[model samples]
Target: MPTEYVKRVLAACVITVLSISNTANGLAGDTKEYRIGLTSVIFADGTAFVNDWRTYLTHHLQAPVKFVQRQTYREVTDLLLAGDLDAAWLCGYLYLQHRDELELLNVPLFKGKPLYHSYLIVPSSDTKTRKLTDLKKKVFAYSDPDSHSGYRYPQLSLISAGIEPKHFFAKTFFTWSHRDVVNAVADGVAQGGAVDSYVWETLAEKDPQLSRRTRVVSKSPEYGFPPLVTQRGLAQRRADNLREALMHMSSDDMGSKVLQILNLDGFTVGNDDLYNNIADSIRIVEQGG
Candidate 1:
């Protein structure tokens, strides 16, 4: 063969091999699923909403997205710690417990802020109850044991008021879902409940009947909203990509719709300081301060 003809053949063969290698790598990346664990406390009331949000994330991340949900925060936390999940949306109290093991990705914004509060709620019929102290010896419902808004804040609030948290309520139970906490109180199963203010406001907006049946006795001081987090040791590049997807979600049309369903304004690269108050509450609960 002529010299130029031989060189052309070699060049074509080289291009073919490079193309094959790139295609294989792309397939590998596409097949790797990013699992995200979501606790029930963060559950949006509608399943359709979750599915849409998952689809949006999958598109933006350019990978399959799996949302793993469990009955309790601890179950999801365990899965995340064991590497069953790549990331999770967890209660701040749970995040604080495993802060060293988890990487904070971003915090969802509610009403344009990275902060939310714990709401002390009671049946609308109970007008006499003014605060946690006033509910002494009354039954109480908590959304989850590991919940910052649903459990820890109430515990800390009672402790701060010089009341024995353990003995203050005649009975206490876990409703598991913030919506259920509202339901439990509305149905008179419990005289009062601690719930995420974000959940409460969302419910109040979409289902006025439920919100009308219950009343907010008080709202706890603002705490960092429950956050999206990844494994502590996830590759920096992968983590950054996931973080970028979330923080920029609001800019996408589908992403913005999902945020509306979630009753959130958007997301931001929240700071460690937003959760400092929660860490303090956790320490007090553990150390009996």
Candidate 2:
């Protein structure tokens, strides 16, 4: 069963939190909440799943923590860049795009793997489209324009097949979240969609009825999972505290429970080199090779 605490923060609250000034510090010696930016990539409906994270971090950092939710990865990245957030969990694509201005905090370890894939999914009843090429001239969904799995890697697959996404699909739309992409394909709103494979699999376990309606037609090569990052100039002491909290999350009872809810083993320090594959993929897609 999903944790009961997951129902605490409704989507409206998340949006309201994002609209405020969430700076981590306000005047010296004054207690302030550490604002963490989260995009819809992982939590599309609400912020309940990460309620425990807030509790754990508050206890460890000895400061209040507020989760600032955004509708897209780009928005979260922008918040972090503008110093409105102390840290953010963002897609690997956006991390690489702004690596020069950000500092990697940690990368999640899922089932012992630091790598993840992008799934090209189609409706289960669609026998005509067994592979990506078969979906040519068909309506498709992409999670976000800046998403590596949703856009870049999928576009690379098309380039590999001697096709360009713009000229290949009958229609293409951004759903802004992997779950939305899955639903779009399952409901026949889109013939196919590209999504984070981890999100697809998680939904398969949590909502089989919705997930079962779609099938993965292809899987992109594994790349670094999305990472938690902070602005480069964030206070070293605070950054270390946040990193320590995440890395040791599996050691304590509350933290362990949060890790389990997130379907992650724990967090580990990650290097920028881990995302070179995404960088190379972006280059190929941009050069239209």
Candidate 3:
């Protein structure tokens, strides 16, 4: 064979092998089961919620899907970063902190908006506490320390008011979950608590008795809601598949039903810039101002 022709033939063979390898990898991704991590959220039971999410993803992706529940957002993030979880639903605070290490998958839309707030809640019967300042020198409950709406934003709100949570509150503790924060405030275990507004509203809609026991004393400005994220080096084909299934979850009957149960409008593509404000808040809090 001519030297030029031989070189062309070898290049073509190399391209063909690469193409075949890519296709095989895609096929493997399509058949591979995934384990997803979920942070604690309100539900009748964690097991039931996990099963529901598993059913939704398994049906939508047309593959086996398993969900692992973590008691705290930090645990979920740790599992995801350590490669124990294929993906996770993590709070925006943690997402921003580790944004460079992960890829944004989807952000859940609630009531047509992709943002939510942190609410400072006090017992309905407590007339003395009207705002965050009113809770001064009183026991305060915070959700996970890594939670945006639970801890970061609320701390910023208190800082903005010229009071540091640690100094202003008689004592502080973390409830680990927004629902637990609500329960603590309702049961008067804490004089006031900070919680995700979305979780509080969902509880209000589904379990009014628990919600009605508390009143919102203040609300932080809207912040990006928590998002589903995967490791940065995840297989592109697998990430694309999961993103597609989640973004279109509300367009079909089963998906729509699941959305209803989860109190979500649907999922949509997210941008890292959406959480920049959370980062700004973090900076302010960490600087003690």
Candidate 4:
């Protein structure tokens, strides 16, 4: 074969391999099923939520939505970034870390507000300790290293007070969920932990069971709220359709029920401005100070 022809053939082969890899990895369109994978925080359990949201979305889109459940924030983020998942309900910090690879589709309007905050939780007995600095050298429980309210804000609070998480705590552990972190502290698994203040409030207000065990220690400064995100390069029309479904669906009684379960009043259009601080926090963690 001629050298020029050989070069052209090699480039074509490389492109073919990449296309096949992406398809095999769940990137390519297959059978036109409009599947939506939700990250953690959208569900308290597995089955009921997928059924509820799918009913809402598929009714509007006029297609069946296979609700795929992802176990953690990281897993959802990876799937969304890789184009394996069509959409995700994601926290601000996760979106911040991967915003370049994703687009904000919609944000949930929780309790008639679009923003939420974090809480520092110590035992109810530790009333005198009021600030981040006061808890140094204490055992701490974080839900996950990648969690926004559960890890990022608490870590950033410590760094702002001139303490690094690895150096500040006597020990650290992951409980994998906001409720678990709250339970760990109340159960004395650790001296304290951080959790979503919204979860704390919602559980306290709605679940008398969880409220009996825990109380808030302090509240972190508010940052951008969590959002619904779609993979970058998702078709613009599809993104618009999904956003319209969310924003306009809250007109009837059934729509209200879905919003109630999510602790949301409705859905709203949002942009990237709300998450800039989260990106700053990520940079702090990466720089180790």
Candidate 5:
């Protein structure tokens, strides 16, 4: 049984869902409406990009939809588990953490595959770096405590190399977004940092100023990619409709425009097995790795 708090959250969620269903279903005559929700691990700008993506989904599904910006992955998962979020864009590790509560609508595609890596980075001019051990006692920035590549994967990488972030660095901070982590190192606010290598690579390849300021110190082994997910209890037909909308987003469509803004190629269908490695890593971290 869910706890009292979970029950309360679930109750609120049911109310919201019922209200939306009544309003949208009333107009549909016989068709169903899916109040799809979108959540991302990025900051406000990333949230806006997702909102644009949702706009395309709404048009494609011919139903009402909404997107919400989550400041942290943990918060988004909480909303998802409580049934407040109909669907979300989640990191592999985050999804693994709440595997029972949410299901993947599909995997998001970047340049290609449904996989990416983490990067340990320092300013290009910082001659004193080569490996994770080199940055011992240095100032470091992470995106968030719950972030996959940005925090968890990088933390695990350090542990694998025989260092725990809480004890290894002189001091560490979370910049809360991959872009800011890069900026922090570039500005010398941090001597080094960890970020999603994909975000870093995309920014460097596309944004000259950012590329000029930072350099990759190391990269983690590849892991499952981030994905667009929906709550587990969502109606199957509704989920399928949402998936179809995402999977078909082409360069000639609204998804294309949103993808252009988001620097993504598009989305693909996925399942829970994609994040097994993330679950393994979580166990490693929890066991004091």
Candidate 6:
């Protein structure tokens, strides 16, 4: 069962499923409406930012921007696959998992690069613990099952160290939000956790008191940042327009403000090579490389 707090948050989210019959005739001209899915992770712990981003995008594109929110990344991906959404910003892991079904659009530039890391963290008071092995038999919090940083990287670490992830941790739980994973560690609900570095760093900048309660034990090698993607069959011109709007955001005042709120430098025309590391990791973990 979800906590009452999560229930409240979920209730406020917007998720509209529209059919082709409802949008096809109206999407091409000046009134083009773009329905985009924002993965749960990108909600980034701020309603104000999400609202501002929607307003900016809607104005920039001269169209209605519908942000579809789901509680999980998988749900957002499903919306893309089902043709209910025009495009979505999803985790890199999901990109590789369904590479053939989704087409990459744009990748956000963070600190001038299109890359981020997985953070391994523990409560600040656990100074004696230094690495993954030190957390053996302790409780752990994971962000999401479909998240590479939150779920896959930690499991990969365990396997590389020759430890069984299932038996090594005394207990584990999924917080469904990377921000919540940090909260779980800081609050001592979990002694250790795996979280997205970008999310943690953003929180560290915006809320030092909370960030100070947890210490980063290690960071995974850099991986491509999460990216915007359209389904394989989306119209080329439609995808191109959305991609152009994102890549040009830094030059526009309102778009610049939205970037500041999200703490992203800008968006880039990132290529598949950016996610090669992730694809390689998938092979190593799945094929016993």
Question: Which candidate should be chosen as best, given lDDT against the real structure?
Answer: 1
- Please provide, for model 5 over 131-200, each residue's C-alpha lDDT reduced to its tens digit, 9 standing for 90 to 100: 8788888899998787788889867776776676688889999887788898898898889988887678
TM-score of 1: 0.89
Which regions of candidate 5 fall more than 4 Å away from where they truly are?
Answer: 1-51
| Candidate 6: regions farther than 4 A off | 1-30, 43-45
Of the two candidates 2 and 4, the one with more favorable TM-score, higher being better, is 2
lDDT of 2 at 247: 93
> TM-score for each prediction?
0.89, 0.87, 0.87, 0.84, 0.85, 0.89
2 versus 5: better lDDT goes to: 2
Candidate 2 wrongly placed segments (more than 4 Å): 1-31, 43-45
User: Which regions in candidate 4 have their CA more than 4 angstroms from the true location?
Assistant: 1-31
Give lDDT tens digits, candidate 2, residues 5-45: 55555655785675443442344432467889987556334
Question: Distance from true position, residue 24, model 3, in Å?
Answer: 9.2
RMSD, one per candidate, in order: 10.0, 8.2, 10.2, 7.7, 6.1, 6.8
Q: Distance from true position, residue 287, model 6, in Å?
A: 3.7
- Over 4 Å off in model 1, which ranges? 1-31, 43-45
Show pairs that collide, candidate 4.
Answer: none
lDDT of 3 by residue, 1-289 (tens): 6999999999999989976875675576565677788885433335665577678788878777878787888888999999888888889888888978998998999889888889999988897777788877899899998888878876888788778667888999999989999999999999999999889999999999999999988888888888899999788877888898888779877777778878999999989888888989999998875
What lDDT tens digits, residue by residue, belong to model 4 across residues 18-74?
767756644443324465766556535547755887787777776557777666888
Give the per-residue Cα lDDT of candidate 5 at 12.
100
lDDT, candidate 6, equals 0.87
lDDT by candidate, in order shown = 0.88, 0.85, 0.84, 0.77, 0.76, 0.87
Deviation from native of the Cα of residue 89 in model 3, angstroms: 0.5
